[model samples]
Target chain A: MSDQKEERGLRELYDQDPERADYLAFGRKTETDRRGFLKGAGLTAMMLAVGGAIPFARNMPSGLIPSALADTPEDFTLFGKTGIIIRNDRPVNLETPAPLLDPDVTPIENFFVRNNGGVPEATADPEAWTLTIDGEVDNPLQLTLAQLQSDFETVTLRMQLECGGNGRAGFNPSPRGNQWAIGAVGNGEWTGCRLRDVLQQAGLKSSAVYTGHYGADPHLSGEPGRPSISRGVPIDKALEPHTLLVWGMNGEPLPLIHGGPLRVVAAGWPGSCSQKWLTRIWVRDQEHDGPGMTGLSYRMPRNPVPPGAEVPHEDMVVMGPMPVKSVITFPDTLTDVRADEAFEVRGHAWAGEHEVQAMHVSYDFGATWVEAELEPPTNRYDWQRWRARITLPAAGYYEIWARATDDTGVMQPAVVPGWNPRGYGNNSQHRIALNAA
Target chain B: MRGRKLRTGLACACLGLMMAGGASGQTSDFGGLPAGPGQLETFGNCTACHSTMIITQQNFSRRTWDEVLTWMVEDQGMWEMPSETRQIVLDYLVTHFGPES
Candidate 1:
């Protein structure tokens, strides 16, 4: 059958019954190909032709879906075109489907996207983009991207950057901000100069206490004077070996959506601290009160609070390294497994600045736990891969849970952590249900 | 070989969408929100900067919605909504995606 005829046939099928089109397109009933062949060789050819047009077929449903559905950018790497839950679009906020995550470093494409404000109108010229270091520094320096490469030593390390409110959806009241589930966190290899090296070149003053970060994304309201977000980290955290002024992600130039021509990879802290489209690093003599630092933006109560209790800003402490956490990246929740088969459960675990000392898996909802094989981290801030195998005794349904302990002796809580108004740092045990039938 | 894999992937996606049984695109219209008195107005205003999915996904109470609106205006630089329109949207949101309890 001619390809054009095949294409026409497929298009006609789509135009008629979208449901049937979906069924055929997905090849769910491939066993009935003989029946389709009976219709004609054209139909069979069209099925084969659909493979070559996968990219096109993936988008064909857009025309059929209601126009109220927003259009995703064609070029940006998406975890899954249909799997991700987009929370916003101006400063794009996309959540990752937990299942799409890679057990190792998250590829730039699968990495969850979180933007504070609208994307910059102008694309940065890597050669011309400059970063300025000023404020309490003895010698303010303005260095272009080219100079940043030539003047400093470059290093690469695998690190995890997680939004403070990553699992905020678990909050009982369901916090007011972006309600991410598990995909708001990712581990990636970052290539850049150490933030300390850049600060050293500028000669930090003894009084320097914090480093304010400035990025190029504009405010959502289109205000020129106010940036969308301009947060900072403590000077000590800025000087940590893993804190980087990175231009590369997963061995490629940082994607603009994930912050590029320049951004800070402030490892072990809330992703907000790692400013994107970073243009300037201003050393401050006092704690910097930039865009997201005030009140309870990223702060949590120093002591646990009642799930619904409110705490004033003074009683809240600035968010630091995240608590110990683990997420199952394999066998996704609710997957069907063969009864009596020993299946491997795999996941990734990380603890803020501390190492993931151990991981425990429970098959009977938390009644009993067994140690999972924990793989050592590849780098200082990298997540540790872990796995455990279990054979179902009988076929029914089962819930698998994973909990990790940090070097600091902090273990994942069985229930959601102390809830704040914003619902930050919810390092609760991760669980997935599967049917054995 | 890659072409075959791509075809299989597309086929799987189609089956998955069929099983889910709704809009087949990456995003949904109005995020499956039910049409209401202020649906259009809410969509027009809230979606100016984001998808309607953002509004539909939240389960905040009326009080929390008010606070969120305040934060968006004061900190996130969202323009202040006129009181009447604001009331309409708030009522619509509270009624539709209000506190889960």
Candidate 2:
């Protein structure tokens, strides 16, 4: 459309005030909101008339907001989300800024979102959701949301959900996916019923060796029957108490963007394993071969590969629990602190399926290290917050690096770890830079 | 204090709302991609789904770009182009969009 002018205006407003500009630009949902804004503002008709049509025309829903027309970052904002960097607007992959991830239990607002498909329209009324438990189960139960709540005993646990590609951006030679940094990880106090209880009630058959998960999100290719992504966990993992059919996040109904109503909360694993808008759990006799489960989606190379070597699908191994990782929260990377000032350097550290036993801070690269006070996690999967007092005598520019060692004594690599095709699991030490002028 | 620039990421140049009050027009117009033979085809095909920001953000080897395209077609359901057109796009991508370049 001739909305180069509108984009210019919106970008100007955004530069001045991001939230306000966001509210003005987005802040509207529902077909009513879409029709009301577009018809009244006449931008929709203007866009149609001028551009003929948008690209990926087959994929856009009726009232889809054109993100390409957006001013900066993205032209899209969901209900109650801010400060997230939009990786891809089509499937709604969002990454939170590392500085904003300071809280121990990530609030719904601050939590990152990684969607393989558009949010299902069924999220509008989550109460009507139905979950089917079939395939290798003695008792296949079709449970509704109300039935699930009434039947299962609910429990809450603080745990971490990280994307397998959380550190893909750090990979050399550059991978071809969302270039997420450390922001793809978050720890949240999730409240839901144990998956074990449900499977136990359903009575899993001896044939069940794994579980295949299915969600209601639509395919990105606009095919009605094509699944967006179907992934799952091993049988033992699916039976963990921490692996939950989550409905509440930080004491609120899981926000739709974060996979609300009903979804999996398999902590310490790839967030994809915790399928959002969960609808089905297929107990399988073998390893699940779903869309995201195939080839190199979440698999890492078996042997260490050089930076740009091609890896065969058969040689890769499916990633298990994430490795030990940490990030500095306070004194953001862009921060400017006064010289010779003593301040508390604080952050959070976690190991997938492991407890972080020690945390260290390096002021002058890895040449020397000082121990930070690390707190014991409330649960096995919860990230432990660590803090230390440090003074910079004089600063031109300084980087503070954080390293965490798991109970098993595995330390985060100082640089990007070995590379894989899809760039999974690079738990390099997190470093933040600050300047003193 | 550094006077109002929190997000100084050189790669994330096109944030729609949380902007740095800067020129993002470059991101749409090929992100300053040099003029080449297959530039038009690359723009139409690549930007069909994502922004040029996604493209320019990458600093890859020619082989990696090929793998990326192979994934796009095989896994991500990208429409298959003619072999000739594919080679042109590949050559253009490898030439202008390499680590050294």
Candidate 3:
């Protein structure tokens, strides 16, 4: 509460005194904020170094440079995570490169990290971690990892997890936040109990209509009470057998970077629905209105708003299942395929809340199309691998395109589907450049 | 106590920041915005919450820039700037980081 008051005061400084407002915003006390910050030790040193060009002389965070200016550091791929495109470093938001995501089951090292806030400190012992279930329940229960394991029936399923803004980079005029390509996704076999089973143990009251999630991540602003991002599903979606409280990923203890100690994995939904480092589940009688749930945060315009329209809160709806999408993974964008006589191409296709009924590949930019043989998903909600063979007509500067059609008849668009304020639900067909000699 | 304030001003912003020490260039930390009118005010106001990368990377028109500013206050928790300050910052952004620039 005091932090909220302090922040409001800091914001008011801009109107209070425009001249010294910026300096005063950071000062601990309002009384001494203006002149004291102007004559501080760091400013004194900075003034000396810049030879009294005092107005623009305050350096960033004492020798902090923009990550773009710095070369890619060797140490970014920590905890065996590798070959990822790091869009921002402060909160550690990184995405996998398309090539590295080719594996049948995405390896942990190649998985993307989409952190909205600070990565919570790695638990010294994960087993000691506990989870709290409250709100609209007959009995609120606090359970440790051991109890969660022994108390509930566990199930393992291979599921596809994709960010809501997976292909945001393709949006023209650009959308805000992480400019992810088609790599902010992964499929892994997660081991956990159904959220339904656990919530029943808490004895949900009939009024439990929605759920709000909370996690260990603190806000990027370093505010202790603030949550980085919290979102949840409706009562019906929450009750799905696939909605799991996952503790393990791909046969290993969930790595800390991947939200190890505990997380909620609601497959086929936007990755945000699967809260990482989950600590609390607040079952609500109404829809959850937490950070990521309200307004345009992870929502699509209910009625398509023009590119730059100032959409009202009511026009936006919380993101639901991901759209049908496919990506070419194999034959790895080989620069030179010797005058191809039917070279094989393969990739993964997934339909959110549906199945990929068909996948088509084009070597000549949609002028011609050929069907790829789609394999059955190892389990429902898992990605299906598809393969096809194509022969280029007198190869020279060709590209490979892949698109998927969902069971419900939605086809991947060759171009971006619709422009929302945040550049979400971009299920554009993915293509890779290749030179055929 | 005042020293701590300056550090807080420099050390953190609204969006997350990394303390990559030994950075030699002050302007680089300010996202390498070239010196111009409103440069100081813009840096002071914006660097508090976000790295200039957010600004430097955009390719919006002057109109879009204005809309983004309005949206920042309405949706993204940015305080409404004083009228003069807002005009100055807008002018600086368009001049230095507009689509044509």
Candidate 4:
């Protein structure tokens, strides 16, 4: 693509999704230009540098920079009993263990951390941190945590928040972003005021079609004017009873790593839609094009393409709710099983925007499958617990596969659904290898 | 505390390698990567943005690795490596972490 063409494409992208355009633009800006840009936006570049300016180069020890940085103290625990994988440290992208996510309500600690930019240096103080609701609204409002609590009814609900590229590692050709396994998702109880009620308080104008969320996190390049992530959702989805400006998780104050103080709990949509460390909500006349919104960030090709084929931006569609998927949480891979006895296989199944209708288990590499008993979902948007007992027909190395069907009758594909440039949704069957002795 | 211990352990390992005259060891304690030609180059170039864990976890063909490197440089703002260095790093990655059946 020519430079002019790319620039035009980016401008078009900004028109549609400014957040994603800003994300892309942040990396392209030269250091000199970046400083000028930050100053133009009324932000101090020095403050951003102190906040965490891509420390990988400056802090790296002499010789080869270690995989894990030494001088930089870990802001949070990087590993747990679940054997969580650390992808990056500065911005902190941690993946949960798939086999450890059997619980219906994922513990806040176990929930995956996906940060696009550096954590803000300013520690959140609920008393002082305020959320501004403005743009295309009849009554713009600036409400603090206290006002948020006293002014609206607080409700709690269990919901699943999943990265759009949760299973990017499963792609054959693979993608360039974070190579997440099937662990970049979690179901949690979020307590907050309904986004609809909060929006109604601001009184949305007739032209409001989407929203743009702003958060405290700084860009990875340490640009103060740019947000790490600032995506939004449609007005209807924003107004859903379940959409919330959440302050608590699992009955406790929201953890900073998980976007504490205030965050949007946009259940069912890609987790990017739920902006963390939320500080502002801008109602827009069109789609809120924020970072992670354009150029295959959270968008996927509408139709499957041959592996490694490049598709134009026009053919891509924004990823909304995820697909039906299941994870084998018990009888982990390489587990030893007695051939003479029947053993129970257990796991969790979830379908975004739709309830899981049924689940099936296959012991012979999906040659044959048997229906498994699925416990009803405890709450809307929560994963369903599933279990099945299987008697090994013969002693050998066997693979157990789990497949879930959603209420829409869409079943999990046996392999990656389709090849996209970025590997957006890969809800293939979950397989666990076991030793049947 | 754990980070400090890990750094100390890595230093000890490197010293041991130097004493043994094994300039290039088979594995590194840095990110548990297998040491080979261009390993240091790869680490120095890539770890500036992400942890070695990200690269170590991926298993891809040389072609896919090349594509990933191109995407990083062209889209993700990774500094473009010299052609010869890129080839050496690509070879090391392909030999150590090629596609799995």
**Separate DockQ for every predicted complex:** 0.29, 0.13, 0.09, 0.10
List the lowest-lDDT window of 10 residues for candidate 3 chain A.
Answer: A1-10
TM-score of each: 0.80, 0.81, 0.78, 0.75
Candidate 2: clashing pairs of residues: A72-B15, A72-B16, A73-B14, A73-B15, A73-B16, A74-B16
What is candidate 3's CAPRI-style docking category based on DockQ? incorrect
Q: Rank the candidates by TM-score, best first.
A: 2, 1, 3, 4
Across A1-437, the per-residue lDDT of candidate 2 in tens digits comes to: 11121112234334433332333444422243222233322334323322333222222222322334342353333444566665545456667778788898988877888887766763556777999999999999999888888899989899989998998888877776777878898889998899999999999999999999998888766668677889999999999878999999999988777877899999888888999888999999999999998888888888988987788899988788888999898978868888888888999999998999999998888888989999999987999999998887786888899999999999999999988888888899999887865
Q: Candidate 1 - CAPRI tier?
A: acceptable
Query: Where does candidate 2 chain A have its weakest 10-residue lDDT segment?
Result: A1-10
Misplaced by over 4 Å in model 1 are: A1-83, A122-124, B1-33
Measured with C-alpha atoms, the lDDT of residue A74 in candidate 1 is 27
Task: Mark the regions of model 3 whose C-alpha exceeds 4 Å error after superposition.
Answer: A1-79, B1-28, B31-43, B61-83, B94-98
The lDDT values for all models are: 0.74, 0.74, 0.74, 0.73
State how far residue B72 of model 2 sits from its true place (Å): 2.3
Each model's Cα RMSD: 10.4, 8.7, 11.4, 11.2
* Chain A (candidate 3) TM-score to true chain A: 0.82
Per-residue lDDT for A1-437 in model 4, tens only? Answer: 12221112222333332322233323222233222133321122212212332222222222221222223343213322124555544456777777658777888667888888776643646867899999999999999988998889999888888888888877877665677878898889999999999999899999999989999887654445877778999899999898999999999988777888889988778888999999999999998777777766788888778988778878988887888888988977898998978999998888888899999999988889999999887778878899999999888988999999999899999978888887787899988888889
Q: Candidate 1 at A139: error in angstroms? A: 0.4
The TM-score, computed over Cα atoms with residue i paired to residue i, of candidate 1 is: 0.80
Off by over 4 Å in 4: A1-76, A79-82, A122-124, B1-49, B55-101
